[model samples]
Target: MKKLLLATLLLLGIVTTASAQLPKVMLKSIDGKSVSTDTLSNNGKPFIIDFFATWCKPCNRELTAISEVYEEWQEETGVKVIAVSIDQAQNINKVKPLVDNHGWQYEVLLDPNSDFKRALGIQTIPYVIVCDGNGKIVSKHNGYTEGAEEELIEEVRKLVNK
Candidate 1:
């Protein structure tokens, strides 16, 4: 228990202090297109990177909430969402079906080996990373709560207002 608490604190500290460029890692889109993490952008507009898995309920709820308002958000702010699924390699086949069932329109990326997640020091599912127009990570949230998506859009709104 002590070790777990210590690790949690350490990860929290890392998350708070994280403000770096996205690492270069090649991942496959849900439709099998190759994409590089370093190139994720929204034409100089802010974007969000949400890490999740098929088995995480909180992740699903958070994403579903975002999906509901994604169109409006895009029209208002030009903010794009990149949903990264950290399901294991064997479970890769589950991602597309789950995404389709939820009707999530966000760009879905497959991180079968968690290379992208580990590169960002993420230790939990439902992790969210908000990036500025320049592709620099500006904000990160580690868990989901009701209405948290509102807070996320607020963050992007700030960048747009700048």
Candidate 2:
């Protein structure tokens, strides 16, 4: 009986891990448009999905860093970025102002309930996922540092060219 229980638990773990590797689930854009993870993939461009919050300092730092090189990154790799805010209902209103103030050129989406974040197992802000043109999650990074966005840009270029 113990062995059977252990086997069952192992199977469940495997299933959960496999599901996490899948592409982004459906989510609503801040503008109220219905957007799906598949939509970005079908756009035939590599994209970055940044799971963040308005109050997260690291998230803001990552965005600021990315903003510095975003224009050139776009020109070089034709990659688009989508910043997904995981702020709860009360804080949702802050997303636009924050993005605008930072002058971030990336697309923004709302994940108030963190549906996408939970699906991707994102437990912290500044979590980044890179998706290929086919909507597959190619790579993911957690947290951020001074030059992390540059590494992210490099990942975007690599995926876009793949």
Q: Whose TM-score is greatest here?
A: 1
lDDT of 2 by residue, 1-162 (tens): 999999999998766543344445777777788887555643777778888899999999988888888889888887888899989989988999898898888888888888878877778778988776665676778999898887887777777665
- Candidate 2: stretches off by over 4 Å: 1-24
Clash statistics: count for each candidate = 0, 0
Per-residue lDDT tens digits for candidate 1, residues 1-162, read 999999999998777665689999999999999999999999999999999999999999999999999999999999999999999999999999999999999999999999999998899989999999999888899999999999999999999999
- TM-score, candidate number 1: 0.89
TM-scores for all predictions: 0.89, 0.81
Instruction: Give the winner by lDDT.
Output: 1
Give the Cα lDDT of each candidate. 0.95, 0.80
**Alpha-carbon deviation at 158 in model 2, angstroms:** 2.2
